[model samples]
Target: MKTATGCTVISNGTAVIGTGAAPIKDATIVIRDGKIAYAGPVAQAPEVEPDATVIDARGGTILPGLIEAHFHPTYFNVEALEDLDIKYPVEYVTLLAASNAKLALECGYTSARSGGSLFNIDVWLKKALECDLVPGPRLAASGREICGVGGLMDWNPDYRKIGMDGLVLLVNGPDEARAAVRKLVKDGVEWVKTYPTGDAASPDVNDHHTLCMTFEEMHAVVATAHNHGLKVTGHCRATEGIKNALRAGYDTLEHGTFVDDEALEMILERNTPVVPALYFELASIERGPEFGLSQRVIDGHQETLEGGAESARRILRAGGRLGMGGDYGFGWNPHGQYARELSFFVNYVGLTPLEVLTCATKTGAEILGREHELGTLEAGKLADVLIVDGDVIGNISLLEDRKRFIAVMQGGIIKAGELFRSQA
Candidate 1:
């Protein structure tokens, strides 16, 4: 593609660790029309046109924009509330979602996937970001979670009613499950989310057992979603529910808290990616009381934290694909702390600094099926890049410091940085 007007060039920076091992120093990246035209050693760069913008890197490290494969945008502003009993209006929730989107971008995430949320708010947010009506990352969203009748949320008085904010769609049998998948598709959802298990934290519910849909029901959901070109993500922490979701062919498992040896092996065999929302668990424990969450939920959260590290270690040892995502919005976990999850993955799961970064960037893109479009810093890719002040390869903690981000560019636009002010 021809270089568009107001093209930008980032030069004299150390291209940080990409998906592959090793870093390229003294690299030059050419951004033409909001896409990377070239990325390599400075010596090999093409001659820059007089009108194109050139930015000095000051020896900083440049890397591809980070990707968070799982999160909840609706819960971004939970801190504003004082009590758990305060039921937020749907409009307020949508605004919170928009704020989270912007916060994610500010935190250096160029793209993210909302695991589940209400009213398809992410869909609208994605559009807003594309149109530049709002500042945010590109979002792939699951409209609403499909659950069994009287599933995680109790609605015994009227079983037909789904959860508030149009967030949950209740389906009873195989046929209903299939229809639910189609309904989300028609609603323009890019991914489908379902609960194969109930919420363990609720005091009223049984935490150990599986809250299952029939085998046929799960099968129909998977098949229907696949046929419609959407990936199915299942919420199942209990062993039985996790196994059932796997057998049903879910593309990814969210919050796999109780996966056993057999289930882990099967996950490895199937090459299914697991997103352990460890940060969310920790945050929940910290903020549960404020949410009026029963002691059972709080206790269950503590148990998840205690065991989550071991589970992550086992999954890594088994060679299963892993991605980083803080299920934002459940409680205290907010939108901007995407890097916090990496600390848990590194300290608890024993991932090296580079490995953890790779999981968050390259591996995360693969899970979202946007490897070609989003991950890595290479020729012919979107110019989603971040420049940090310190050497990220030597110390991963540098990534957590917001001040370290000297420049944030997404699609060649200088979203942050004084260097591009003259160009603008």
Candidate 2:
């Protein structure tokens, strides 16, 4: 909550820069009033203030603080579809959301864009974070996910007489979709999240390849959201759904799992950012059985994992923007483990460590539309930087280990890691 007023100097580290260039050895980063003034080789760094606070990186890797592009601050320990909304009342879920926000900040995520939240909780969560009432990432809230009546999120049976209103807004047609986007605009959401297709979670009903919202409804959502100066993203899995989203002008695509050649070409042509969110599928396949998930569900997740990884590889190879972060509040993939997505991409999706880092930092900010302000270590950007205990390029998994975090800075203020603890 504190605004950093004095100048600060971070030196003696290899800077990754988050610009896809080669890492700079013996780099120095200068901060002034919570903005980066310089970031480059020490030999070319400008002279610092005489009484500036100095932080030694200790031969660690300096890079931009990570951005969780497909966050869900409202979901916690979700084991089943019902667990997302029915397991906890809205009041309790709000508290849990606050806790998850703090955990994201401590885990080195300086910014996040909520993929979806319950009861528009992320809107209020963003306000609280701004007021310093709770610690959290810089959030772009999507109040609630927009889905069709029998979509992937509407898993509760009609006989149960329960509504999915807590987590999703179920619309019947294009008019209803437009109305829903208006409601989100009134609720102060920065992005509109919609479901263009079902998910692997609902195997029998609306599986991964099944379309949920029609193309007309999807078009209505994008048109309405864009009119209000808000971007739109979709939970797109099927090939047709991906094309529909692209045709409807969706700003981003989540879990674009079954993208085929046509969808891939469309995604590249539109320059749309895609979040594979493959880690969630990995977790479901590897650990779902322990949580009583049925064999069918596990197999569905396996299929989703393979399809998503392949699509992600193709997108990256075609030079499309691939963002990181998604579905981190499940029982298998809990909060505070957001960095696992980075490692998953590097290890399983065949991305180099540096490529994955750029995806998490630079492309992530671009997806959020804050690239000029939040991403990279370049001058004239927010001073959100991470100092890892070792060469993160050499050991990409080092970022997943909290013990290796020497400092996590947001707006030039030390928020977590060794430096914050020492100050405390």
Candidate 3:
């Protein structure tokens, strides 16, 4: 339930302050009317009214609620795109999408940005969550992916040419590209997704070398999106595709698994955000056989898994903007395991535990363009807090356990981790 006005004093916790990567011992955070009123050392804490609700974190780490910078709420958790379309009706898929939204919040994610969605369901889902018809993270929706005809999402038999409606918007030229972006804007999306390159799962094109849409077409889409006050991102895996997308001014690159030195230089120069969702690729490798995927498809994933890690390492080492978000909601990866991406970043991508947490917290907010209000725990910011019952700084994997998340407060509302339900 949303509190109209409530004060919460969280004492006896180690507060992980925002952006600076420091912790306050014996911190006391006072939340008044759903905003962080005070967050500092216990000695400097402001005196609170006796009636205010108090939550003791038991000396656990209190960090900002994680933001899933790349999300697809309508996807079938663990199912491939083709299987999602073939195995389930749209009605079932819609219900599952709503379920995924809630799971995201339960996992301590307070916000999510839609990477893409089935139909315009993400736009409606965002609204539903806003109206409290459903429980979910704050979403920035991208209605449907804009793709060239015969692009990555052109998943259909050649002879039948079955309409893949509600998933991909097929465009051919610059005119069609511009039209598609305008239509997505009209459909109430904050971002427009495009398939700049074919993915590893595609049956029609090479995963690493093939370009899906022309440079001119992407330029048109980016221009239209920017003009309409929408961010534009692309599913780019090919080195050439990355170059084209950056040149055309796409704001973010999803699955930038094949970034060459030249592409990396351009991304650094433009300060573009890259979300290399490597967990999904790893999941594909582990569960492809169970999903009835061809060995060829399973074999192809290894390259992406290895290449994506190296690409991320390079980007991180070069001090480029890299964020965390699993391409969850597929059959194997699932929705609530977005934290696995953080572990992948630490172990495989060669980042420290603290670095991974920073990416998940601060860099994720930067990716969503909500760094001002979200991300770090600080005074005057929205109280999106995740209190984990462990030395989370020593082992980031503890965050993967929802039970360890003793309290999750989004705008001072306890959506999950009801640590003080009896007391309240």
Q: Who wins the lDDT comparison?
A: 2
Candidate 2: pairs in clash: none
Each prediction's total of clashing residue pairs, residues at least 3 apart in sequence or on different chains, is: 0, 0, 9
lDDT of 2: 0.92
Please list the C-alpha lDDT of all candidates, in the order they appear.
Answer: 0.76, 0.92, 0.84
Q: Per-residue lDDT for 1-424 in model 2, tens only? A: 4558889999999999999999999999999999999999999988876999999999999999999999999998787768876788889999999999988988899999999999899999999988888888999999988999988888777776655468888899999999999999999999999998988788897988899999999999999999999999999998999999999999999999998999999999999999998999999888988998889888889999999999999999998989999799889988988999999999999999999999999999999899998879999999999999899998888988988898899899999999899999
Which residue runs does candidate 3 get wrong by more than 4 Å? Answer: 1-4, 158-164, 420-424
lDDT of 3 by residue, 95-162 (tens): 98999998899888998899898868999998888888998898889988888887778776556444
Give the best candidate by TM-score: 2
- Model 1 — TM-score against the truth? 0.88
- Please, what's the RMSD in Å of model 3? 2.0
After superposition, which runs of candidate 2 have C-alpha atoms over 4 Å from their true positions?
159-164
The lowest-lDDT stretch of 10 consecutive residues in candidate 3 is: 157-166
Q: TM-scores for all candidates?
A: 0.88, 0.98, 0.95
